[model samples]
Target chain A: MFGKKRVAIVGAGVTLFRRNLKETGKELSYEAAKTALEVAGLELRDIKSVVMGSAPDAFDGVHMKGEYLADGAGAYHKPYTRVFVGGGTGVFTPLAGWWHVASGQFDTCLVVCEEKMSSCYPHPQYAFTTIFDPILERPIGMNLIWIFALEMNRYMHKHNIKKEDIALVSVKNKRNALDNPIAQLAANITVEDVLNSEIMAWPVQRLDVSPTSDGAAAVVLASEDVAKEVTDNPVWIDGVGWCIDSTHWTDRDLYYPDYVECAAKMAYKMAGIKNPPKEIDLAEPYDPFDYKELHHMEGLLLCKKGEAPKLTREGVTQRDGDLPTCPSGGLLGCGNPIAAAGLMKVCEIFWQLRGEAGKRQIPGDPRTGVAQAWGDLMQYGSVIVLRR
Target chain B: MRYYQSEAVETKDIKEGKIPTEKFRPKAKFAWSAGIAISRFLEELKNGKIIATTCSKCGRIMVPPRIYCEKCFKPADGWKYVKDTGVINTFSVSFLAADASRLKEPIVVAIINLDGASEGMGIVHRIEEYGDWREVKIGMKVKAVWKPPEERTGAITDIAYFKPIRE
Candidate 1:
C-alpha cells in the first residue's frame, strides 16, 4: 500500500489463444515470457523475481505445475511464488507481482500465466464437473454450462433482459476482437447470427460461451526507478484488490455480482477514484459468458444495476463511446484460456495506457483503466487498477 | 474445423482417447500429494473401516478428515474411526458420463454423511444393487459394501458402493 515504491508495467507479451497448440504449458509460458523480455529490452538475468499463475493442475494433468513451469518462465534461481483463484489466477498473477515491487522487496518481477485446457481426456469441459460439490452438485450431472445458463436465466428473468440484448455483447465483443492478434474467435456477426447458433444450454447458446483455448501471457513489472530507466512509457500499477464470497452460491442473490462490487470498492478506494463511469476510461471486465460481462459491469460500478445491457446497446461501451468496456474484445470474442484470460486483460490495459493498442484504442488520452476476472463457483473477483 | 455431412454418428478419428498415444509410451505411476489424508481414509475403507479426525481446537468431527482445521488455524491432530454405515444427506443419478460416455447403465452416486461425523461430512460413492439408479433418493439409508479381504486395493472403488440395508 506504500505510495513511493510505485510498480509499473514496462512490457507485455501474449501467445495466440487457440483450441490446440503443439506447445506444452511450459512452452506456452516460455514463448510469452521471451516476448515480454524482448519488448522490455531486458534479458532473463534482468528479472529480480517471478510470479506464476495457472488455473488448476487438473486441466494440465500436471500437479505442482507452477513449479514445473518456473524454469521456462525464467524463475530459476529467483524469488518466485504462485497465486491461484480458479479463473481469477490470471489477474491475481500480476497483483502478486505488484506486491513484490510495491513492498520495496524486489525491483523487477516477471508475471506469467498459462492455461492448457486440452490435456484432459474427452472434452475438457468435463473437468468443470469437479468444480461443484462432489456430493450434492456433481452427482446431479451438473456441468459449467448449467451454472452459466442458470445465471443467464436468472439475469434475464429479473431485469426483463432478452436473448437479443445479451446477444449484442457477443456481437460487439467478437467484432472488437478482430483487431487483437491473439484473439481466437474474433468475428464479424450480428445478434441474429448469435441467436441461431447451437444451444448448449437453453438460455446459453454456444456463441454465448467463450472458446476453450490453450494460451499464455506475460508482463514485465518493475519499481519506479527501474521502470523509468527501462522504457519511455510505463503503465503504473495503481491499485489491486480481490475478494471471494461464500462458496454456497445458492444462499446468495444471483441478480448481482456482489463479490465483484466488494473487489471494485477495495480497488477504487486505493486508486482514489470516487466516480467509476466518469473517471475510469477503460474497463476489461471478465466475459467468460456474455451475460457475465454485463453482470460484472454493474458490479464494477461502470454502470448502475441492470444498466450494463442498456448502456451497451446505446454504444456507451464502444471503443470511441463514453466508457469503453472490453476494448480488447474480452474472453467471449477473444478467447477464454482459463487463468490466462485475466492476464490478457491486464495486458490490454498496459497497451491502452501506453497508446500502443493500434486499432483498439479508446478515444482521448486515457489515463486510468481497470481489469477484473471472476470465477470459482461464481464467488471470486480479482480487480486491478492501472494508470500512466 | 473437421466437418462431416452425415446424419448418423461417426466414430472414426474421434481420438480414441483411452489414455493418450504419444506413440506407445509406458504408463507412468503417480502419487496423490500432501494433504490427502482424506484420500488415504477413502482408500482404507477397503478394510471395512471408516476414519475421521477431530480438531484439537474446535473439536468438530471431520470425515474423510482434514489434516488441518481451517477454523482453528492449526493442525487437526486427533483422529478417530467412524462406522461405515451412514445416512444419506443427498444423492443423485448421473445420466451422462461428462463427455458422452454412456454409463451402460446410469449409475447412482450418493453423498452420505457417515455416523458420528460432522453434520455434512460424506463422500460420493456408487450405490450397489440399487437395480435402477433412479430409485436412490435423499435421506435413504445405506451402508458401505466392502470388497473381499483378498481383493482389497486401498481406494474408493474398494468400498464397492453403498447398498440399502436389508430389512
Candidate 2:
C-alpha cells in the first residue's frame, strides 16, 4: 500500500562480523554490495540510486564518511544519499531505498550499511564518549554501558524482574548463534554463565552486552515490476516506520520504551496488521542488550508490558515456538557492528521469509516477519515489515 | 548463504606494522557553546545556585535549562531556582571507565530529579560519599555538593557530586 509503486527487497548480503576486520570500510561495503547485486542477478549499472548508512564519523575516524564510501557502495556516478539515526540507520537506510523506488524516481536502489568500530583507538567505546553533552554529561565521564545499566535497573525494578530472567536471553541468543555461520560470539552457555560474567556496570554484565564489531550489510530494493523480473522469491516491503524520542533521555522514564511502540504502531497500521502478536509470524527486534529484546517486544505490542519475560520463560520465542524472535542470533550472538547489525536483522527476515535461513530457519511456514532497530541515545526506533 | 566474507585482524598486526596501516591521531578540539539557556545555568552554578526554565504553556519546569520549551515549541516563560536537594530517579554502579578500562573505585552515577523542577526533570551526575553502591537506591533523597567558590568554574562540574542526605 505504498502509493502507486510498491518496493520489494529482491536481494540482500552481509559480511562476517568480527572484533577487528582487516578490510577497510570501503572494502566491506563493496563485499556486501557486490553480493547483493549478484544475488539479485543485477549489475552495479542497474542501480538507479544509492543509500548509505553508517553510525558515527568518529567510529570510522573520517569526516564525510558517506562520500568516502560511495564508490564501495556502488554509488559511483549515481544519485546517492546517506542516512544517519545513530543505530537506527541500518533499517532506516532501506526505508530511504523504499522511497527512491516508491516515489517512482528510481526503479532500483542499493542500500548499504557499514561500520568499522574497531578502528577507534584504545577501545571503540571511547568513540561513544563524544555522544554525550560536551558541557554537562561528558564531564561525568560516562561509559555507554552506564546508560544501559541505568535503564536495565529501572526496567527490572518496575517489573520486579530478576537478573536470572534477563540472563536467559544471553543463553538463548548465543546458543542460537551456534547455528549461524557468520556468528561471532556463538556458544552454548547457561544463564549462570551470564550472571557470573564480568560486570561492566551493575545490572549490565559483559555477556549481557554485544561485542563491538566491524562489518557491512547491503540490500537491493526495486519496484514491483523490477522485482518480478529479478527473483522468484521477492520479499515485499509492506510497511516501514521510524520514530525518534526527545534527546533528554535522562528526563524520561527508562522503565519502558515508548518510542519503539510509536514506530511499531505506524508500521503495523500501514501493513494492516490488527494483532501484531498473531499476524507477524516472526520478529527480529534489536537485541544489543539481552533485556532490549523483551523491552522492544512490549514496545512493538507483540506482548503486553511486563509480559515478555514470562513469554521468554515459557520458551515461546524459541525458533520452533509460537513466535520465534531473533532466530538469526541477533546482535548479542551475531556481532554488533552498529549500522551493520541493524541491517543484519533486516537481512535475516528477508532470508527467513525466503526459506533460505538453512539451519537457523524456523520450522513452520513463516510468511510475514518484522525487523526493528533502536538507536540514537535510546530514543530512536526503525521498523520494517516484510512479506514473502 | 555461504558467501559471507571477512578477515579478522589482531592488535599485534597493527601494532607491529604487519598490517601496513597508517595510524592517525586527530587533535580536533572544540569549544562547545553552552548556548542561551545553559550559559545562564552554568553562571548560576558558579554562584552556588541551581536554575531551571519554566514553560508556562506546558506548565513544566525543566533542568539544564533551555531557551525554548521543547514540548510547547515556544520560548520558556522564565527561569526559576530549583532546590539543590532531590530524589534519585535511577542509578548505576560503573566499574569501567569511559575507554572500557577497569577503575579501582567504581563510580556511582544517578539521575537526580531536582526538588522544584517538573516531575522526571533530572540531571545526570555522579553520586559519591556512599559506603557502597547498593546503598544508592531510587527515590533516595540526595543533595548536590558544590566545589569551593574560589575553585568554582562556570560548568556542570561546579557541583562536585551529589551525596546522600543523611537523616
Candidate 3:
C-alpha cells in the first residue's frame, strides 16, 4: 500500500524451537540474527535499522527486554525499536521493518523475535496470568488455559462440533511437524491420541495446545533495489494489517473472531485480494490452540464461518490440500515460543515461496501466502500478505 | 547459515545443579487505586449489590463500571444497581490453579452478564457447583452467593461465587 519504496524479505532464519534452550534470550536473538544476515549476504554494517519483537518480559524474567536484546539483534549503531503486541509481535516485527524500508528512511532493516518462556519459573503459563486485568479478571485466580477452554467450549457449543473433529487439527499439525527438523513437539499421533490425552481444561486436552518454548526467529527486510541486489528470489511484502478489539474480552461472543476478520480484510484489500479462498495459494493462521486454526481461518475469510473444521476434516487444510495451511506444522507442531512462533510463520511463507521448505513444502507451486497471528485476550490480530 | 540449530538444555540439568544458575524471586507488588467508578462499584458489592454505570446518550449500562462511557465519550449518567443474577456467557472447568498446580477441587469459572447491564457488559467470576458438573451449560441462569455482610470486603471476592438459580 506504500507509494514510496517497496519492501521485501531477502532472507529468513530461525533457531530450533525447543522447550528449554541453553542460550539466553539475547544469545538466541544473536544466533537467529547472525544467520539471517548471513543468508542475506549482509553484514551488521549494512543494516540501517533494527526491529525486535518479544512478548511479555515475564517470560524472560528480564524487564526492558528490548534494550536487553538490542545489541544481539545487530542494533549496535542503528536506529532500533521493539514491538510488543503479545503473541502477534512476531509477524508485527517484520511489518515494522517493512515500514522502516518502505518509508525510504532506511535501505535495509533487520527484524528479530525471541521468547524464553522456559525462564519463567514454575511454568510459563504462570507468566500468562499477569496478562489479565488486575482489578477484575486476576482476582479470580485464573490461568491462561481457562480463557482458551471457555472460548473453545463456546465455539464447539455454537457449531455443534465434536471434540474429535477439533482433535484432528492437532493430529494433522503434529504429523506435519514430523517433517520439520526444528520442530519441538512434532509427533505422529491420531485423533484418538489427542482425545485420550490429559485434560488441562475441559475441551482443551494436553495435545490440543502448543508447547511453551524458548526460541528466536529473524528475517531481513530490504528496499526494492537492495532486495534485488541481495537475493534473486526475494519475497515481497504485498500488504500488512493489524487490528485490536475491546480489552474487555468477556463482553463479546467467543464463537467467532471479528477482530481477525477486520485485520484480514484490511490486509487483503491492500493486497488486491477479493477472494482469499481462491486467490491465496496457502496460509499460516495462528494455531496456539488447535481450534484456533479453524477460528482464524474463518476470520481470514479462507472459508465460510463454521466451515473451517469441515475443511480440516476433508483434508483441505493439509500440506497437500487445496489451501495448505500451516504447512510449517504451525504452533501445535512447531514449538510455540510466542513471538517467535508468529515470526516462524512469516519465515515459513518466505521458505515456501522460495521452494526452500525441504520436506514440509506444499506440492503445488505456491506464489502468494498469508501469515496471521492473534494475541492479547483474543482481541488483537496481525496479518501479512507475501508473494514471490 | 547451513546446519544451524539451537542447543537444547534439559530441565533436570538445571535442577541437579549441573547447569550453573542464579535464582531470584522478587516480591513485586503494587497498590492499585480503585478510582471513582470502581470504588463505588466495590462499595455496592460490599452491600450485596452489583452496580453499573449508565450512559444517557447511548442508553448503555456498563458493569465493572467506568466513569465515562466508551461509546459516547461522556460522563456516565449515574450509578445503577443491577441484578445479582446473570446468564453464563461462557465458562471453563479448571483443574489447575493460577500457579499451574493441580487442584483437588476443580474451579468452574464463568463470565456472567448481569441482568440489568447492557448486552456484552459482564464480569468474570467463579461458578459454584450445585450438584453434577455436567449440569452446567451455557445460558444457564445464575445468582451471586454472597458472603455474610460482616465477612464482606470492598472487593470482587465479596460475592463468594455464582451458583445456578433453580426455579
Return the TM-score for candidate 2, rounded to 2 decimals. 0.98
Q: i-RMS, every candidate? A: 10.8, 1.2, 1.6
* Candidate 3 structure quality by residue, lDDT tens digits, A112-137: 99998887889988989989988777
- Misplaced by over 4 Å in model 1 are A1-4, B1-97, B100-167
Position A11, candidate 2: lDDT: 90
TM-score of decoy 3: 0.98
**In model 1, which residue pairs have backbone atoms overlapping below 3 Å?**
none
lDDT (10s digit) by residue, model 2, range A115-137: 99988889988888888988899
Listed in order, each prediction's TM-score against the native is: 0.75, 0.98, 0.98
Q: Which ranges of candidate 2 are over 4 A from the true structure?
A: none
Q: Once superposed on the true structure, which residue ranges of model 3 sit more than 4 Å away at CA? A: A1-3, B1-3
Docking class of 3: medium
Q: List the residue pairs that clash in candidate 2.
A: none
Error of 3 at A129 (Å): 0.9
Error of 3 at A211 (Å): 0.8
DockQ, 0 to 1 scale, candidate 3: 0.68
